[model samples]
Each structure stands twice: as structure tokens, then as C-alpha cells.
Target: MSKPITKTNNWVLGLTGGIGCGKTAVSNMLEELDVTVVDADIIARQVVAPNSDGLNAIIEYFGQNILLPDGTLNRAELRSKIFTNNENKEWLNALLHPLIRLKILTDLNNATSAYVVLVAPLLFENNLDKYCNRTLLIDVPIATQIERTAKRDNTSIEQVKSIIAAQMPRNEKQQKADDILNNDRNLSLVHTELVVLHKNYLQYALQNTTNAP
Candidate 1:
């Protein structure tokens, strides 16, 4: 479903998919085509940088174990902790999500490309489609997701399945997408579909960009 954005210049494309669905590859391709991408994963890291308020909040709650020798957040340790302990995960989300949302809005407002792609793994789950003009879902089979993620992350298929099960299911995502990128095949096919979406986004942006009153 499409949401009404009051600003025309900030036309946002909320791009999302399941784990190991090649969202990184698709975002890179869109970037190569000159689309500005405000990625949630990248923002998530930035919010907890060494001296930030978000980091301080995290340390106060999770303690020093969440940090590395170099003062960066210990992402692996946090991932393990949160995945294993539901309470820890919920507490962390309570602390970080508001900060992340504020940063995302600032980034989107500052974007200079024809249109922006806000790449997020949990776009739908977080109800972030509210910030977007359209939602783009990249579709891939679960077996493929398990295979690719396990291979790329050097983890087991079971671990990948656990991660996938924790997310919004593939069918639910497909149903919510305003536009779908069928990415079950090779890069060439993905690129072909992306090019078409690129054109569509450009036209949408141009049509929606309003002159100042």
C-alpha cells in the first residue's frame, strides 16, 4: 500500500526483503544508477558510535560487555545476546528505535538524488512504510535464502532458518509490496527488472516534485 507524503521532494522508496535476499546487491545497483540510499543497517551502526548519546544509553543498559576494545559496539555479541534473550532484545529496541527513526528522517530530508531508497531489513515489520511513498519488495524463495545466507555468513542452515522465521514471512511481504522485484534468478534478470523500476521511480519523482508556493 502507498502512503501520502506531504513533501514531494522527499519521495521515498522503502526497499526490503528477507535475509539473504540480495538486498545489498539491489541497493548497490540502485546506487550505481545514482539513486541515493538511506539504509537502516548503516544508520543502526551510526547511532551507536563511540561517543553518541545512543551509545551511552546502550552502555548504561547493556553495560560494557556491549562494547569492543576500540570502543565500537560489539555487534556480534549484541546479536547473540538479543537473539537468545527476548527481554534483552526488546529493551534494546526500546532504546534504539526512536533514535534510528530520527536519523532516518534527517537523512531522507537531506537526500539529493532523483528519489531515495530507504533500504531496511525490517521495513514492513517496523511499519516504516508510513515514511515511504511506495514499498518495493524483493522476492526470493526460502530455500534459496537459507542456502545463500548460510554460505555467505559461514553459518549453518538452521541458523539462517531461525533468522528467517523471526522476520515477516515472504508471502506477507509480497502481498504488501506496491511493486515487486522478482529476484529468484540471475543478476541479469534482477538488473532488467531494476532498470524498469528505475524509470518508474524517476517519472514518479518528476511528476510529484512540486514547485514552492
Candidate 2:
């Protein structure tokens, strides 16, 4: 294991959950409260943009067939290739994880909010939680995850299940989390809970600032 990447002057709250578990909703609520959110998904796309080094390297290894007619990545084709082959998945992870992590760190460090939310689906899997002052998991039942993801993405249930299997298990994530927010209820209820969490995070951020030498 590597040491946690230290932030320059921000309190980071690592937020994650399995697909369709309302991680976005929670992040959005926090953002409405003026919290800075450093989203790994957005950074992932930025790192592999049309003319990026990440894209060029991917094309070099997987060939131009991995790209679309518009010179952007053919994500569906690449996803199919990686999902069926563990070696390809590992290779892709090796190439992209570091780049994503660096970009996430940069964004988090640059954020000017009282606290920052680092939102990554693979937060614990990639050891990103280690960078946080605390970790939060947006939890839901597996059935809910499969149903919601299938409906939202228009993907088959089996495909959603496969993606869920690839993630850290729900119980394992619960064990790792410093806080867990059950997202099985309505959005209004979730937001109500989040307001309290947001206040707690603000206080933690203040304490971190006060204690910094």
C-alpha cells in the first residue's frame, strides 16, 4: 500500500458507492451547499479527451479501431473488450488510474470551498479514500442498484449485475466507510440527512484548519 496523497490545504470527504446508488444526488446536494466536488468520472473523461496523451496511448495499444469516426474514443467497443478480458482491464487500469488520480488531486487541492467532496465510484477500490479526512458511502440494496441502473442506463439487468460484481461489495464498502448514507428513500429525505452531514463536514474542515501547523 502507498501513503495517502496529502492535500495542500483542504479537507477532503471521499464519497463513493456502487452504480445507481445516488452518489450523484448526494454530491449535488453538497454542491448546492457550496461544497466543492472533485468528480473522478469527469476527470477520467478529461484525461482521455480526443487528443490527450491518455487517448493516444490507448490507441497505440488497442489500435485506431478503438476510436470513433469523430476521433474520440469508441467507449462501447473499448468497454466490451476490457470486460471480457481481465488482462486488458488490468492494462487499462494501470494506464488510466494514475492519470485520473493526479488530475483529481490537482482539482481537490485547487478547490476553494470550506471542504471538498472527492466523488469516485472506485474510491476504496483505488485507495482514494486514504486521501480523505473521512469516507462516506451512499448505500442501497443490490436489487435497487440493478433495477435503477438498468432503467437509467437502458442496460440489461445482467450487464448491471456484472458491473456491480466488478465493484467492491456493498458490505465491504460499509465496513470501510466512516459514514454511510442509506439512499433507499426519497430524494427529499436524502437531502434532509445531507444537510446535517454537510454541517458536520464544515465543522471538521474548520478543525483541520485550526490544527494545521
Candidate 3:
């Protein structure tokens, strides 16, 4: 069973955004500010590493074509397959989410920092936000999201939009955030916002106890 969410001396922050919303950039800024940031994407990759059960399960589902001759999953080929095909997409999520959740919770329970930031692209969609004391959303305009991702990933606009469509919308994310950082403009502004968030979260962490609501 999952552990219950309670206010603790350790502050748990959920950082999330839609595709191409610059969540990684915002997370890097938080890390610079001394926050203990745990990225779900990073852990996802780790859980599925060669010889791991997660990778084994994925291979069983999709077969050897999804793997390298060296035995590692061919991530690029897998991405191409799932992102282009709707059925394969759901199949992938069904294979991955439970194991990812278990890994995240185990890591989070062991965290000793003043606060731990869980950076998840689908924080709300996956219902992981319930564990966070506060949720932060990194936001950008749809046009900005498409353009930035296309330039960075070297993919077409339609491809970027396809990824975006698979995620929860920006407005829904905004409504759920306790804090929102808009990164479409000046980078400095985002840093300033993080400063405020760091201070506020520190204070919140101090006051939080097992009984805190």
C-alpha cells in the first residue's frame, strides 16, 4: 500500500509542466538554489536500465527490435514507435507507471534534505500530486512550447504538438499549482521567482509537523 501524505519536517515539492514547458530549466535553477531535486524522468530511465525487471518487461512486450545488440533498450527506436502509434503509447504507459511510482515513493521516503523536489512532466495526470506539500508548474505559451521543443529536439511542430496532446493541458496544470513560474520571457525573472519559492518553502517546511494539514 502507498504511504499516506502528511505534513513533515521534510518539504516535498512537485514540479510539473506540459511538454516543452521548460520544466528542466526551472528544475536546474531549483537545484542551484540548493533544493534536493528528484527527477521522475531520470528515475524512469534508471528503473528500466539493462538487466532490470522494468527493462525486461518492456522487452517482453515489444521484443528484441526495441533493444540494442549490446542488450540496452533502443530508446530512440522505442520513442519513434510509441510516439507515432496510439496503441503502442498506452501499452508503454501501462508497462511503466506502476514500477515508476513504486521507485519514486521509495526514494522520496528516504530523502533527508530540507525539501525534495519531484520533477514530473505528468505530475497531475499520474495522480502523484497528492503526495506533494506544494505543487509548482513551469508554464509557457503553446506557441512557445511548440517552437522551443522543435528547436531543441530537432523535431517538427506537429510532432511536438502530438506530445503536447498526450499531456494534461497548461490551464489544468496552472489551476493545480501552488506556485507558477512563467519562463517564456526573461530568464532572470524565473530565477527571482525561485528565490521567493525557496524562502517560502523553507518557512513552510519548518512549521510542518506530522499533524499539519
Candidate 4:
């Protein structure tokens, strides 16, 4: 089990899964029920948006070739760079993780719903689950992941596999999760499961509120 780096008053439900594991679908259902979801992927992009401090720092490290003609981060180029070099990946993570974490925490703090859902693909890999009251893993088979991601992203199987390789494995995520939802079925079935989880989260939030000092 990972230890939390910071304690928060909000009842945070850490939601995660492997690439293409239907995390967005689950988070959307929760949103329909009025749950506030803080998405780390969005924050990750925001931190590196054009002209931002994060982008400036990245450019300082990687030079002009890291940007597109539009002056935006060349994500594919950066991905290829880091994928081939462990040291570069580590350096990049060291630079960006703190910025991303800070933004995630800020958004979570501002959320007004009964509970906040912190949706992060790298939740366990980055140890972000330590901030949650409980963690939920959306699990699907590796075949499903590759198929879904390649279809959705219009990417090659090898590219999808590489992305999966970069993520924490399904078994490892399962071992760390407080709850797991199998997402191999259709959206309707997945939503049904989520409804139950939503109710449980609401009840847990109420309990936490009642128990607060």
C-alpha cells in the first residue's frame, strides 16, 4: 500500500485504470449524478499549454524542436524522446509531476460536489491515490485495452501496446485498488455498476462528513 503525501478534508474517490479502460465513461456517469471529477489528464495538458511556465520550462530543456509550428508542444516528438530514454523520462517526470499534482489538488479542493472523483490514468504509477479516501480501478483485459484504444485513437496496435507498456499493469493496479469494476461489457452495464458505486460513494461521503471533527 502507498502512503498519502498529503491529507485532504474532501472525500476524494481516486479513479484509475489502464489505457483505454473506460475511465472516462465511468467518470462521466458519476458526473451525471452530480459528482465533481478532477481530471489529471486535463491538468497535465493545461500545465504545458502554449506560453505557460511548464511549456517554457520544457522548451528550455528540450529546445525549439520540442514545439510544433503553431508553437505548441510537439507531444509525439516528446513521447518518442522519453519512451526511448529512461533518464529523459525521469527528468521529465521530475519537472512535470509536481506541477500536475499541485493543479490536481487545487481543482479537487475547489470542487463543490458531495465527493470529488480524481480521475488519473497514472494514479498508482504517480502515487496520486495517496490523496484519496478510497481508490477504484476500472479493469479490463489487455486485449480489450489494445482493441479499444487503437480503435478510439486511430493509432496502430504497436503504438497502443507501447502506451500500455508505459502504464502500470492491470494486476498491479488490482492489488492496490480498494474497489475494482470490470469494464469489458457494454456502456449500459458499466453504468449500472457505476450507479451502485455512486450510491456507495455518496453514503461514504455522508459518513465522513458526519464523522469529521
Candidate 5:
């Protein structure tokens, strides 16, 4: 693993939320504002890309059935297996978390942003908040989560509900947050909040660091 960003300088903001809470939308807005955003989901996929060490390790343990005909991960099949079985989930995490963490650290260390956002759906669950100077939670009602997720994923409401149930709950995440972005309404409303947040984060990062990340 690459060495962590120097301890004397801290500019990382860990951004997270439950399913369908619009974390991606917020991240996109931040990116458009020229803030660097390192998405863990993207890194997670990279670590397990075909022929990578992560993928080879996974196949060694879980068999070739997890791969699609094109030699890529059949994510839906793997998701069903892991979530249905606790041991499977634990095993997958054990193999992949270190790989993903190394990549994230390296990216953060190299980033030139005034501050960087480390976006992870499992930011809290995976204890990634430790890497951040602060945590930002995108908040929404459970009903909103279920409704939006069902629509976006083309899955049943029950399936969305089950996924939500498996993740850290909304209330718990909200309580742990250092900042919140309420995403209950339209994008314009969320964008308004984000404008304030972008300024706040920029100022906060400037206050915290002597120089850029």
C-alpha cells in the first residue's frame, strides 16, 4: 500500500448515505464545482476487474460462476450470494477491503483539490470515516429511499427494502454525521444545499490545512 497522506495535513471529507439518498448526485455537483471526488464504488470495481488480483482471489474462493460470459463480474449474482449469506459477505470484505483502501489512500495523497471527497456507500460500515476530517451524510426518509431505489434499479419495492435493511440505517447514519444534505425534494432544492456545502467545505478545508491535498 502507498503511504497515507501526511498526518500533518488533513483535507479529506468522507461523503456517504444510504441507498437512493442521492449521494451520486451530490458528488457530481461537487465534481462540477471542481472539487475532487474519489468514489469507493468505482475503486471497488477496479480492484476486481477481470484478471486483477482481487478477481483471481475471488474466483479461487467462490468459483468461476461469479463471472459473466465476457469475463467480468456478474454483480447481480454475486450480490445475491453475499447478502444472503453472512459468511460470504465477510469473506469478500476480508479479501477486498485492503486492496480498495490502498487505492483510495494513493488517490487522496495524489489529489490536487483544495479538498477531496471520498464517496463510499459503505463509508461508515467499513469504518472509512477515520480517514476523513469530517463525515457528510445525504439524508432522506426511508419511504423516499425505497421509492427512488425501486424506480432507479428496476427492482421490486421489497427488493429495495431488503437492500436498505442490510445497510446501516438512515437514523444511525444521520446521528453520526458531521454535516447533512437533505435530499427529500427535487435536484434544485438539493443543489441549493450543495452550494452552501461547497462553500462550507472549501472554507473548512482551507481552515484545516496549510496547503492543498
Candidate 6:
């Protein structure tokens, strides 16, 4: 159900978490609550779609071998390149971050909800958190992150550790959050927490709007 109408125009909420922290699930839950959701990863993929300028830049930086026979980016190949090479990883981020940010801004500008949820795995790393009025972090333990990632991605522990290392520390992320969603337990508990948070957010929105010019 939609929140009661108030003077608050809109809010941009950045949703983030460490690897395997269920950020996607939280985004989905927000969408089910009728909150607009803008996903950075989806926008990143769009900007890199075949024949796009992003694809061209990537090819120039890494060569055509990263593309499949049909000329689409072979994500597995690109993942391997960036994951295995630190410089390549930096180059990819440099090329994609600006483009992704632009698209995210465009999407946020058109959002019609009381607030919008922007899901970014590296919200802090990329400094995109600055664009948000509030930040929501999905908190999960480091050990759980490693175990979940290893099992979910079907990758070795070392590989999972590498990905985790590439992200901000869990404690640092938690400290940066305006609101924290603990996702270490089952869905039932998570849903109850979300319900309470949603009500609080609605009240907050109402107050903010009432005080706005």
C-alpha cells in the first residue's frame, strides 16, 4: 500500500551491503512495498550492452577477445580479466562508473515515489552514497559473506576472499549506514524488521515534508 500523502517530495535512498549480503533481496522487498527502485548493476549492464559506446570503450581498452562471436560482451571473459588484473579492474571501473552514474541520475530524477531505493554494491567505494539522502545497509557477518559467496557463486574460497577484499570492510559499511537491515536470519524475521522500518520511514517522510518549504 502507498504511504499516506504528505508534503515530502521524494527521497533517494542508497541501499548497499558487502558481497553476499542480500542487497538484491532487500531491493526487491522495497519494490514490493511500492517504493521505486533503481538498480546500479542493471544500469551498468545496459550501458555496456553490445554496440553501445561503453562496449566500444571496453573493447579499445581490453581488446576484442572479450566479445563473443555474436559481438556481445562475454561477461565471463570480462570478469576474468578484471578479477585477475588489478589495472584492468581499475580501467573497467573508470570507464563504467561515470556512465552508470549518469543513467542512475536520470532514473532517479524521474522517480515518482515518496522515496526511491538505489541498490549499489559499491555505493561507498564509488562514493555514490553522497547522492542519497539516506543509506540502507544489509548487514551480514564476514564469515557468512565468505561462505554464502563461495556456495552461491560456486567459486573457491580464495576467489571469494579476493572479491570480498575488493569491497569496503563490513564494519566500515555498517558505520556509514543511516539505517541497517540485518539479513543474517530467515526471511520471516527480515520481513518483520522491514515492516517496522517502513512505518518509521513513512513517519520520517511525513515530518520532512511538513517542515519543507
Tell me, what's the RMSD of every candidate? 4.2, 3.0, 3.2, 3.7, 2.7, 5.8
Error of model 4, residue 196, in angstroms: 1.3
Clashing pairs in 6: none
Stretches of candidate 3 exceeding 4 Å from the true structure: 1-9, 76-92, 210-213
- Which lDDT tens digits does candidate 5 get at residues 1-213? 965443324488899999999999999999999988999999999999999999999888889998999999989988998978999999998999888998898888778988999999999998888889989999899999999999998999989999999999888998899999889988998898889988988898888775544
| lDDT (10s digit) by residue, model 3, range 1-213 | 966533334569999988888888888988887777888999999888999998998888888888999988899999998877999999888878877887787677778777889999989988889878899998999999999999999999999999998888788888889888888989998888789988998888777754467
**Range of the 10 consecutive residues with the lowest summed lDDT in candidate 5:** 2-11
- Return the top candidate by TM-score: 2
- For model 2, the run of ten residues with the poorest summed lDDT: 2-11
Clashes of each: 0, 0, 0, 0, 0, 0
* TM-score of candidate 5 to 2 decimals: 0.88
| lDDT for each residue of candidate 2 in 1-213, tens digit (9 for 90 to 100) | 986555546899999999999999889989899999999999999999999999999999999999999999999999998978999999999999888888888899899999999999999998888789999999999999999999999999999999999999999999999999999999899898889888999999999999989
Q: TM-score, each model?
A: 0.90, 0.92, 0.86, 0.90, 0.88, 0.86
Q: Provide the global lDDT of candidate 2 against the true structure.
A: 0.93
lDDT of 4 at 194: 84
RMSD in Å for model 6:
5.8
- lDDT of each residue in 14-93, candidate 6, tens digit only: 89998898988888888899989999989988999988999999999889998999999999999999877999999888
Between candidates 2 and 4, the lDDT winner: 2
Taking all chains together, the TM-score of candidate 4 against the true structure is 0.90
Alpha carbon lDDT of residue 199, candidate 6?
A: 75
**lDDT (Cα atoms) of all candidates against the true structure:** 0.90, 0.93, 0.85, 0.92, 0.89, 0.86
Comparing candidate 3 with candidate 4, which one achieves the higher TM-score? 4
Mark the regions of model 4 whose C-alpha exceeds 4 Å error after superposition: 1-5, 85-87
lDDT of 3 at 175: 89
**lDDT at position 168, candidate 6:** 92
Q: Which model scores highest in lDDT?
A: 2
Could you give candidate 1's per-residue lDDT for residues 54-159 as a string of tens digits?
Answer: 9998888889999999999998988988988999999998889988888888889899998999999999999888889899998889999999999999999888
